[model samples]
Target: MRSWCVLVPTAEGELVRRFLRDRGLLQKHLAIQREADRLVIPTVSRVEIGLPAEEREFDEAFAPIRSYRDVIRIPDRVRPLLPTSFDVIGDIAVLKIPDELAEWRDEIGRAILAWNTKLRVVAQDHGVAGEHRIRRIEVIAGEDRTTTVHVEFGLRYQVDVARAYFSPRLGTERMRVAERVRPGETVADPFAGVGPYAILIGRRRRPRRVIASDANPVAVEFLRANVAANRADLVDPREGDAREVLGEIRPVDRVILDLPHSAMDFLPEAVAALAPEGFVHVYGILEAADRTATTVEIQRIVEGEGRRLRHLLVRNVRSYSPTQHHVAFDLRVGRA
Candidate 1:
């Protein structure tokens, strides 16, 4: 059957195979195919393997049964609750375990580490909390550390998941915003977390300057280090509440409001910091049933701020929960 495969030169096939296996990315059920000078190896996921490999799909035969669940040794009744997927951030695997499976968390973590050889830590995530929006993660297996270097689009970010909020799932959304940034434009990220959006924009776009601020001091520390590592010299990292920090900065051509929980609360501050005819990318969690109502509410807020809503584009980024969605509102505003 056809499946996702990585094509690599015959000389580097063994090395790449080891790398993939170590990362728990190699599909154990499929057989690797040799094609003259190149070898086709199947993978469990489609991602950059940091090797000279080309992603392709081809017909391949299945091997013997080898799944993480097969060795889990759990009761048949609770087997269905076994997580099939988790978030992989660099060398760490984060799992959101159900409350019922708390007793088997250590075994689950071990199974995950066995399934993926490259992971050094396995953490059970209890979601974000507190004023800093930090994740409540506990080490269930392997090393006990929340710090790791995550690579996205060739940029390295030293992230501490326990101290700050960083979502690997937002890679596409960050790129979308970065690509829209025009040259010579000044950008501002009020809730910049580890400089994901800011560094990407600074390196990819020829913006005049990017002022990235966050209320969390640890996030700012990592953001500054990431800016230097990524050579995004144009990004100015600031540590303070965004409402106060934005007031100190000059008017920006684009403002990014990433605090989804209460981004709308700061729409007035965002509008105030924006230059005339500027853009604002605001993210929020809204009920999926009534998207139109959210748009109307945004229109009401923008007009109330004495600004003309020249343009507004609403995009559903992803499903935040069963009933709510993570939404992005792209707005272009000017003096009324």
Candidate 2:
């Protein structure tokens, strides 16, 4: 018996996996990082079967992307803006763009449509980039070099991801943190990016109030637009970190701490602002080998605060690096 692993970049893998269907080539390996330009695999098969000669028949037959060239790199941001920088995290092609651009937004978008053939525009940054803010353009081009636009792409977001862009990955760890809200409960999202969670929750759950914010002005503008677009029930959109404006809002039944790098440092302030028995969802990515230790660290933080941290459950969300894991531990904080 012989066995091996072959890692192919997302675009290439996506191109070939269709052929290997039911052959048992794809394994459930942890897709560590998102923006992978190529795929590294473990496989005993070494023969490269090139694509058919009909690739030129379609508008977008090859991969679609542009080089950010490290002028700036979005850190810890898995689902980023498109056609700028990209990496392959498992079978997905993660794309991201810069924070600000003058006139090239449309140009950048056209580049994506030109590169990734019949690609599905899964997400977008809002109409700040005009009609093509961040949408999943459904263009299909494959082996036969056939291109078809089946669906005129609509917003992937059931709720506009404008004013609050909660990282979609966070849902892996904190499943529907906002979706569980009851009517008349106050909620706040301090680090809303384009309102990933806020809009969905506000529109669906009927929360009494939801205050969302981001330090980035562009993010705030998008958040507001998303709130309006989705018809968010009761939300107050702000443009700064939640901690700074926490004093101005009603006491919240739940608080989402999504600040990058040091959300743990915000624990003290978060505890102070939360209502009695309020729930908090925290995000942290640690090494795979450290899963046990990482869970322990989260428990110790809330325990050290002398509060009773209940529901101490840990979720291995996604893969960041080779041996590193993106983990989220959720707990309910109350008086000790």
Candidate 3:
């Protein structure tokens, strides 16, 4: 097994490992090592991962992944890598080849254009640079550890700008709110990361109010920047948890509950904070990957609110960290 250490931002250290570990290939091909606050993943290849079958047979196969490219041990430009991934949150993509092959990056990028008809690339000295075409790719810092710093070099596109607001990428949870939020209505996003739903809604429709909030200072900073960058006039951003902010804030016509990991836990707060007859977009990454499973979770929240899950809209936004259903539900609560 060939190994190349992968260094990532300290904040992303855990996620970096989980993202790769969730793939379950670690036992067979990869290994994660921790050095202080950084992460190191020994990838197994010098070649690219091929396209996985459209339909997976195994249960763990749906894990969120950067690409299906076979893990590479050695770094090489023009190494036929699957430099893009759509199924993961944030659409996270990686395309760092060794600086040794700066020329090869362009050559390989052109070849990729042949295989992936939709993608377009603008190569710099780095590997590849283009959002939506390729979300991110930079040299993994190779120092005491093999990890390289994430140095992005690309044409910042709409998606790149939009990334300022999304958690991973714009999941169904966010898209649901964008489609449903009406003009002249206030929408609250409790767990707004970089304001994807809020900013997107502001641009797409006439939301009288859209307040997006996040506890992570890093996320909050970006959220504010994104809202202002796009349409600062209508959308107001608050930095804090929904539980803390919504309790003291005014009412909203609609609410987007996107903290799927803890959304159910916050149902009480969401329902209590909701406006009379207001719309609530609740998201939950459930175990059962179906509408029935989603409804069950929705009912759990509306149990005592004198509200029933009147109408349930279900969508599989994307694979949630693999195998866990990344499910979104539009619940119309009826007065009990």
- The best candidate in terms of TM-score: 1
Candidate 2 lDDT at 108 equals 47
* Superposed model 2: Cα runs more than 4 Å off: 1-175, 289-297, 303-306
lDDT of 1 by residue, 23-139 (tens): 898887677988899888988867576544555555556443366676676778888998877778889988799988888888898887887788999999998899888899898
Q: Tell me how far the alpha carbon of residue 108 in candidate 3 is from the true structure, in angstroms, after superposition.
A: 13
lDDT (tens digit, per residue) of candidate 3 on 1-336: 335445555787667557555765332333455568664454433223331112111112233333223332324545544344432122222244455655555454444344443334322223223321222433221111211111111101123322232333554445556787767887788777666666777776787877878776656776676566565567787778678877866566777777666577777777767676677877776676455855776687786665666677777777655567777777776666
Per-residue lDDT for 1-336 in model 2, tens only? 222334456777665554443465433232322235754333224434442211111121232234432222333343254343443211122344455542344444444444554443322333233322333322121222211111101222322233222334454333356556777878778777666667666766778878887777766776687677667757788887556876666467877776534566666556667786877767665766766775676667767766677777677666655777666666677877
Kindly indicate the candidate among 1 and 3 with the higher lDDT: 1
Model 2, residue 76: C-alpha shift (Å): 31
Model 2: number of backbone collisions: 42
Error of 3 at 111 (Å): 12
TM-scores for every candidate against the unseen true structure: 0.80, 0.53, 0.54
- Per-candidate local distance difference test: 0.88, 0.53, 0.55
| Runs of candidate 1 exceeding 4 Å displacement | 1-67
In TM-score terms, candidate 2 sits at: 0.53
Tell me, what's the RMSD of every candidate? 11.9, 14.9, 18.8
Ordering by lDDT: 1, 3, 2
